[model samples]
Every structure is written in structure tokens, then in C-alpha cells.
Target: MTLKQDTTSITTSISNPTLLAKVDQLRDLNIGQHVPLPQLVVVGDQSSGKSSLLESLSGVPFPKDQNLCTRHATQITSRRDKDECVHVRIIPGPRASEDHKKQVEAFQTKVSSASEFRDKFVDILKKANEKMGLRTDLSSGHGGAIFSEDVLKIEVHGPREDYLTIIDVPGIFRTTVHGTTKDDMVMVKNLVKRYIRDDRTIILAVLPSNVDIATQEILELAEEYDKNGKRTLGVLTKPDLVMEPTMRASVCDLVMGQKRPLTLGYFLVQNRSSDDGVKTVSELDQGLRIQPWSDLPKDRVGILALKEQLQSLLLDITRREFPKLVQDVASQIRQCTVELNKLGPSRQDEREQRSFLSRMAGIFQDRARAGLAADYNAHSSFNQTDLRLITHVVNLTDVFNADFQRLAHSRHFSSLEESQPLESPEPSDAGDRSESQSGLSVDTLRVLLEESGVDKISPKEQMELAEILVLPKDIPMPNEGFTDWIKEVYLQFRGLELGTFNPNLLSVAFTEQSRKWGDMTRIYMSRIIVTVHRFIAATLRSICPEEPTRIQLWAEILEGLLDCYRKAMAQADMLIQVQQRKQPYTLNRQFAADLSKSRGHRITALLRPKAKEDRRFAEPQYMVNLDDIAEAAEGKHNTELLQEEIHDILHAYYNLALDRYIDNIFQLAVDHSLLHGPDSPLKVFTQDWVLNLEARQLEDIAGETISEKKRRSRLSKKITDLHNALKILKSRDSY
Candidate 1:
């Protein structure tokens, strides 16, 4: 059997050894044989011992230490053209600047000056290392080091005939993400987040035996992958460096325990010099030959023992745990697709339901965030942004609907066209979205919604489908600038005045963050995740029947969603109060009525009264003062007083915005509570509360005017109050 195309597969051989034994001749050169698998990704922090552990796992030695020890992400696939089937083939991680051809240039340029790799690559790379602030494994030169990058592919054939693909990431230690600016932490965060988020990926943290516990940086990095039960394994690499197994065990326990999502497994491994097949340094002869670990002492001989333990653990994880994950992905794909199809172009009821639920979820989340942040004026901005974002996001459904339309129009399709309907829906890459038939998100929604109804899709299905949607990548960068506004307001509360540069408070100035979720939304990012939770519940229900996964899982999910919604409601409620504060009595009563009304019923009703309120509350000198305020100087006429006056004018604007932020958060919290219970806080709001807030605000502002001196005095009082408020919050639990 050829490595590239063999009837033998890693799993197939494990379950059926007859195939593996038949290929023992191992001397045939063929390319068209083998069931191929995707390359495995081994990721972790640098010097986490990834290299040594990978070699040990694969039972193939290539290079050691920091010596060319994965300077680039490498893909270890298979190549069977050789007489002997190669076990693994490596393709280095693609660099974005690959086309620059810097490494290739240096290779060719200096190599022309000399024939030896040592004379060219090693020497040039050494100097380049210094310039790049990178480390070089310059000892014997070409051991595990890499310099050229026309895609350095490495092939290794193992004794066990396990032809599996593997990916070796560049050492995270030296891999400092280069950023162009101070606030460019976004780019670094994005890169790190990407590496950690790929659900298909597994994290392999390799550390020296001396690394008794992971540092906060590494732990935090690892936590990014912890959610969704991503498999993270800790390897005490260079166990040869540490003399005791007990020490290795202790380190693994401490590090793994401290990490968020518990690691899949742990290993103590070492790489002996020269010859490779992953035996302990003590097990190998000076020439580096593999040896069966005999009755050797545990201390010196245990690297081999450690290797055995890791292999056993890996075997169990692959055979048992990993398959369940794959199954979950499969189920989610089916469910999402089914639901989306129901809401497709033809299903008016489903589409309407989908639309309502989508709006419900959105408005709730928006209010929740605003309320949580105490940003009263955020309501309007959120509504405007929501209008804009949804306009674009819902448009994507049209894209999905259009496709479903074609399918129904053409084939009267009962199933999506594919090799296996069970396959996980593939997401579209940023550059090539058309390639994937439907995103797992799109498919899950369509399928599930379609299936839920008898002759038509059920309302529950529509909501579930919409809920399962993959967040659209194309929503024009939402008013992340609002985050800056939040920071500004926070600064103002701290006596930093209205305009200030405050970094500590503005964590991630872009408000493109997902809403603070209830447990449900948090777990439902992938349509697949929902599917898994359902599958577990469904399958288990067959045996132990009453454990409703939906109600159980969703109960928690709902609580969080409601928390978000309540926050939003409170915010919107506050903003109406602010508007009322400035309005005349009759207008204030109208504002109260509108605030109490359901947000969607007839926004016009809410707006008419509020617009009248704004009119009545309008300062007699509003426009002229605004123009004067806009034209205010930066001269030495007591800038503070001028600023204070400007601040008052802006406060009106700010207060309006604060309402929106708070409302959004409240809504988000409410979204989580949907499935919690009938009496869930997520239950719709009454008009009374909104009106009450308006009345209270009107009373509060009875003597409060937006004049220069009044504005200054109010600012002083509010600032002091806010300081104490923040202190209480901090002392409570540091939300």
C-alpha cells in the first residue's frame, strides 16, 4: 500500500489488524493507495516541548531542542511514491509573507557562493536570527532546523506503518506576533484567537520538565481553546532534563488542573540524539537505535515508559472521545440545514418567525450590554446600529434562501447533494465563501426548522434555527466606536472630564464583542455544538428517558440570555427617564407611556410622544447655544468652565446614548432566559415600567437645567456618586 493512497487507514488498521499485517512487505512504490486523513495540528507555547512530544507520539525522530525545531508551522502528511510507504509528510505552516521569498533568496544567493547547506543557510540564518531577534540552533547545523521556505516538506516512515498526517507549529516562544501600533493588540489577539479557535484543531503544550506549572500567559492562551471541550494535552518534554517521573507527574497535574478546559491527556517524553523512533535517551545506544524498554530502572528508563503511556492515552482518546466530537459535528450539520431549508424562500411562516426571534435576540442583547455598562444613552445608537447590522445580516439569509430556492426549484430536493448527508457543513473561508455548499450554521438552521413542523416548520424550529446561525462575517464593522464612547463616559464619571485619553477603562475599544451571554448562547456558537448537546440528550433519553437536554441545557442558557435582556430593558428604561427629566409634564407623561409600550408594537407611538417631549424640553436657546457650543474656543478663558458648559450640552446627547447601551445588555440577558421557565425574567416587559421611569426622570430634573453653572454642579455631584458606585461594584465582585 502506498502512503499517498492506501486501503489501510490509521483507524481502519487499529480496528482490523489484518490490513496492517498484509502491508508488512513494505517495499512497494505506489502513489495511488491509502485513505487519507487531514493533517493533525500540534499547537502550544514555544519550548512547551511540542517538538519532542510530536516525535515521541509519531515514534519518529527528526530534530531536537530549539534546533530548527519548528520555526514554521509544518504539515506532516504522507508520500507513498517511494518503495517503502512513508508514515508521515510535513508541510510547514504557511507564512503570510511567503511570496516575499526572503528565505529562498538567501538560500540561492549564498548557496551560489558555496555548495554546502552549512556554508549557506546556517551562516546566513545565524545573522538573520540576530536581526530578527530569533534563536538559531547552530550547533551541528542541519539537524531539525529549517531555512528555505518553498514549502519545506518532510517525509518520515514509521516502523508501525501508521501513516498519519501531522502539523508542527512554529515555537510560540519566539513567535512574537509583530504589530504595527500600540492599539494593534487586536491583530495579535485575532491571530492568537484564530489559532485557538479552530474547532478542528488540538492543542499540544510541550514544556520542559522543569516547568512545574504554566505561567498566567500560557494558561490564558490555553484557556482560549478550553471552551467547547477542545482537546488540550500537556507534555512534560525533555523529561531527560528532569530526573524524576514523580516530578513530571506533579508538574502535569498542577498545570492541567490550573488550565480552564481540562487537557485531554498528559505525557512525559524525551528525544535522544541522532537516531529517532522515540525511545528514552537511556534506551538508545550512542548510535540512537530503538530498544524495547526492559527491566530498566524507572528514573533513567522511564522516558520510554512515558512514551508508552502517552501512546496508550492517545489511542484511547482517538478511539473513544474524538469520535463523539465528530458525531456531534455531524448531527449539528444535519439539524441546522434542515431548519434553514424550512425558513428558505418559500416558508413565509418560518421566515417571519425567524425574523421575529432574530429581532428578539438582538434587541435583548443590545439592551443588556447598555444596562450592564450603565451607558443610558446607548439605546438609540444600538437601535440604529441594530437596524443597520440586521439589514445586512438578514440579507445573508436571502443568500441562503436563494440557494434553497434553486435546490427546491430544480430537484425538489429532500436532501442536500453530497457524498454523505451526515458530513459536517463546511464554513466558507473569507476568500472563498462559495466553495462550501452551506455553512454548518446555515445548514443546521434550515434542516432543523424544516424538520420541526409537520406539514410546515414549527415556530420553535424557526427560532432554534435562527439561534444556531453562524454569526455573519460581513456585517459592516458595527458602531465599535460606541465602545470608545463608553470609555469616554466612564472617564467622565472618573472626573477625567468629557474628552480624555483613558486606556485602563476602554478594554477593547471596539464594541464588536459578542454580547455577555447566558450559558446557552455561549455554548451555541457552532450549530454543531447545539447538535451535540441534543444528540447526547436524545441518545441518552432512549436509555434513561426523561432527561430533557433541551430544557436542561437551555435552562442555564436562558438564564444568561435573560440577564442580558434585563440589562437592555433597564438601559432603555433609564434613557426614557433621562428624556422625561428634561421634558414638560404632559410630554413626560407621553414619554412614560411610550417607554412602557412594547418596543416593537408601533415605535411610531413611542417616538411621537418622545419627539414631543424633546420639543418641550428643548432649551429656549437650544440651537443658538449648540452653535455657540460647537464654536467654543480652546483658549485660556478657563478651558475647564468652557469645557464644563460644553459637557452639559453633550450630556444631553450622552444621556440619550446611555439608554441604548443599557437596553441592549438587558435584552441580551433576556434572550438567555427564553427557555428557563414560564416565569423567566425574559418574559416581555410592560409599558408601565417605561412610563414610571419617565415620571421619575421628570421629577428628578424638575430643578435641573442644562445651563453652564447647573451643568458644572450636576457634573460634580454625579462624578462623586459614580466614583462611589464604581467602588461598590469593584468591591462586590469585579464584573
Candidate 2:
């Protein structure tokens, strides 16, 4: 293949002598094996003349039998050579065995004439079916289905052949046939879709002109994969069969780009019917030049026109996709290499197994350390928020302590002194006392009688008695004593009413407020455990890359580790619960001492004697001595002191309990569960434990399954193929 080289641009034309050669070079590179390559993919419903179109283009007689022809993908590469020859081979699918692939490719038959080529191709198909174990008959209903999605590659070189490569896939069917099921139909559609889905592929959606265009499944399928119709070309076959005038008009509309116009437009070609027998390209062309066939546009009515259109389309697509194709292959090579490296070197023997185990242990140990330390940045999988497991537990504990305090100081346990009523002012006059308001003395009665003239008294006697018994007109109302006011204030300050002083009340309130702490503790601990478990499982999968080992680690080993961690956390929670139930205790004595000092000062202020000048005239002139007042004052003071002491004690114990509970949770739940040596979850991956595993245990952990080996082999082969493809593309200096 040669090209009219230009550094700045690529101008492709079907008239260019070397254009087809360039495309043939691409096909020879097997670029399709690694990445999507530019090509023509023929798609149509059953018996839509797809095979005839291909045969007309390549000048080869493809099998015409419906059952045997085009059962699998047929890739034909045609090139011009002085010596005419045809070669056939099979490229097995990824699942096919090496022996089967060789056997299929080994069958070779060359033909010089179109008739010989037709017979040889049919024989090749029959031999391939038998060798590949594909069942062609379904009447007996005892074997596997007939068709496969593998490709049958044919390379033809002749002096008159145009250099081109085209793929022919199985015709799409709507329902099952004798040998086909619903699954077979689905398989055929998927196979066709896989090819047409590639952006690099130019789809030739063939339909018989007699059939409704809407009824052809290939057109719908093509539209789905090529919505813009940019890469799709409609090919209407059997146009000679459409005898009706309306059908001819519709065909003309489709061909003239009027009805459901595609970007590349449509081509109408008439192929020889099945009963017409084999004919040469010269005969077909001469026949097309006669009568009504010659009336249509010469460019749209012949196989020669269709071939030239396809050649131009293929060249244009190849030029457009060439640069992108190179980049895609290079990128795939890098990605596949990285993935293969990650799978690590194969472990086949004892020493290799030991090395693999050591590597896994190291990975597990490092991840475990990072998780326990809450160092989320150590791994890409963890984020800052996920690393706050311990901090969350600590915050939960703080909330619990605050709730306990709130309950302890609630209104139900408030001191009575804080709620006591204040003392009311004593009555200032006799009228102010309800009991003394109606009392009448003899002097009042005598005064009334004298005013009424009931009796007469001497002036001297009246004066002397008035001086002795009459009160001063300006006398001050009787005032309350300082001692009485002090006693009233003391009574109000006394703590605790009747039922509030019960110790059981404090216990009940504490219990009710702190009940959620246990549940919260368990939940927080469980969260931490789950986080660690996930971290370890993810780490194991990354390190080992084996499903069996991952399953075993989680089900057998890691589960036990989680159970142990759970039990430890539960025990720590139990300890906390027990401590909470104990009567609140504390070693702090400063609060009690401060309360005692405050009480002493209040007592001194109450008992101080009143000064002589400070005494009121209506109050007693001498010191008032009331034993009951002193006793009551002393009793109220004692009660206040006792209540203050109890409050101080409980407050101190609440703080101490919080400190101890926090310590216990950190030790048992966080540290013992994950960070503890020897008993820690990380211990499962220690070198000593892994190295000491028995043969059966080691096999269970690191052994490979037959399917896994095959998968790896396939991956390795694909990577190698990609590398080889990249080398070939890169070898072209212009690229």
C-alpha cells in the first residue's frame, strides 16, 4: 500500500491508485484485534441480497445456501495481484481452544475460477462446522446450537480485484426457525450490534426493495446504533423484484435521499436472482446497460457504482480515524500493562507462596496500623470524615455525661430552701390582728358611760389614773425584732421538702437519664468495628486479588476477629453500667469544705447581739429570750448544711464517673479491639501465623482454580496482542 504523502493534510479519493492498498495494509496489521478499526460491516434481514452484493464487489462466489452461508462473520480482504489466488482461514473467538483454532485454520483450498471458489467455500464451511462441533441439524434435538460468532477470514488477490476489506454478519431474524431459538436471535442481534456499535465501522443496512423499509429489522437496529446516520449507508437490493409502481416510487424516494434520508444517502443495486445461476461481473454489467435498467442513474444502478462508493467511504473514515486509532492503542497498552502488574507474579510453588503471603501480610499490617491510628490519609479509600470513629465515640460519651448532669440537677431533686416562702410582716396595731379586732375592755366601757353621764368621778382621781395608764399619743407602732427577721430568713433558706430528700429519687432519675448511654456505647463500638472490618476486607482484596481467599478471610477468619472485638467492647460497656449503678462516689472534698465555711458565716451573722441605741421604742427594752427561736434557727441551719453536702457529693461523683467511663471505652473498645498486640485483628496476618499455615490451609488461601488460570491466560494473551499491535502502529514513522 502507498499514499500521496502530505505532512499537513490527508486528501482521500477513490480515484487514488494507492488508497485501497493503504486500507489493505491496515487490515493486514490486524488492528481490529486490539482496537476498533475502520471497515464496512454488512447488515440486513434474512435473504436480503447481502451475500450477492459482497460477491459482486469482491468477484468471489460466496455460498448461496441459506443454512450454511454467512452463519458466522465473514471477513473478506480483496487486493490486486498479478497472480490471482484466494485463501481462507478462521480466527477463533476468545473462548475457543488452541487445538481447535489450529484445526480450523489448517483447512486450506485454493481456487482459480469463481465456480471453483464457490464450491471450495461451501466445503470449507461444512468442514469448519464439523471440526468446531457446531450442530447444523436440530430435528434430533440432542446437541448444541449450530452457529457461532467467530470470524471466517478470506483474503483474495487478483489483477481485477479492488483492494478492500468487508465483514458480513448473520442476517437478523425476528423469530425462531428449525435450528434457532429466541436465544439464537438475540445472539445474532448482539453480534451484529457489536460490530456496528464501533464508531469506526460503516454500516451497510441492506433491505429488499419489495419489503417495507420499516419492517426491515436491520434499519431499526442501525438507527439505534447510529442515531445521526453519519456512518450508516442504506443499500436497497432486489430493486428489479419491486414491480408495483408505488413500490418503485418509494424506492426512488429512498435512493434520492428523500425518505428517511441518511447522511451517506442510499444505493440501489440489482443482483442476479438465486435461480439465475452463477454469472461473471462482465455479464452482469452488460445486462444492467439494457432497457429499463439503463434508465436509472448509471451511478446508482450497478454493482460497480456501489463498490466505488464504499471504497471512497472506507478511505474517508480511515483517514479521519487514523490519528485517534493510534492514540487509543497506546492508551490501552498502558492501562492493560498496569492492570497485569497489579495482579502480581504467579504463585506456583512453596517459595512463591511464601513471598506472596509475606507481601499480603505487610500490606494488611500497614493498613491495620493506619486504621487504628485514625490516619485516613494513609489510604486513598478512606476520607477525613470516615477516620473520626474514635472522636465520634468520645463525643457520645460527653453527651452522656452532660445528660446525667442535667438529670441530677432537675427540678424533681431541687432543694426546698430554694423554693421556701418569705416571712410576712407582723401586724402593726391591734386592729391588724383578726382575733383582737372586737375585744372590749372595762376602761373602754367606763369611758363610754362617763361620756353618757352614767357616773361622776373626782378630777384628782382621773388625773392620777390617766398619768399611770394612758399611752403616749405619738407612740411608734410595735416593730419586729431583728432576731425574728433573722429566724424567718433562715427558715426560708432551709433545703429539701418532705419527699424530695429521699435518696431513691436521685437514683431513679440518674438511672432514667443514663439508660441510653449503654445502647449508644454499643452502637458506637459496633460502628468502629464495622469500619475496621471493611478496611481490612478491602485491603485483603487489593493485596490478594482472589475471590476464594477473600471469601475465606471474611467468613472464617475475620468473622472470628470481629466477634472477639465485640465481646471486649460489650465487657467494657458492662463495667461502665456497673459503675453507673453504684451510688455516685467522689474523692473531691473541696466542695464540702466550701459549703461548711459558707454555713459558719451565715450562723455567726444570725447570732450576733443587737446594740442598745439600735433598739426600737415599741420593741422590748431588754434582750428578748426565746428558746424555741434559737432551736429552730439551729435546726434550719443543720438541714441546709446537710442538703448542700449531698449535692456537692453527687456532683463530684458524676464527674469522676465520666472520667473513668471514657478511659474504659478507649481502652477496651478502641485499643483492645484493633491496636492490641498478639490479640489484635492484625495478628491474623502476622508472618509467623501465615508461615506456619499447613498445606491444606495454604492451598485454600492461595491456590488457583482452572477457570481463574484460563482467565489470566486470556488476559495475558490479549495484553501481548495489544503490545504487538502498538509496535506495528508505532513502526510507521509518519504516524
Highest lDDT against the true fold, candidate = 2
- Candidate 1's TM-score: 0.29
Q: Model 2: per-residue lDDT, tens digit, 513-624? A: 3454565455445444544444455567656666775676455465456555656566656776776576654455754664455455444434434313336777545443
Pairs of residues at least 3 apart in sequence or in different chains that clash in candidate 2 = 416-496
Per-residue error at 34 for model 1, in Å?
23
List the lowest-lDDT window of 10 residues for candidate 2.
1-10
Task: State the weakest 10-residue window (summed lDDT) of model 1.
Answer: 26-35
Error of 2 at 616 (Å): 45
CA RMSD of each candidate after superposition: 35.1, 22.4
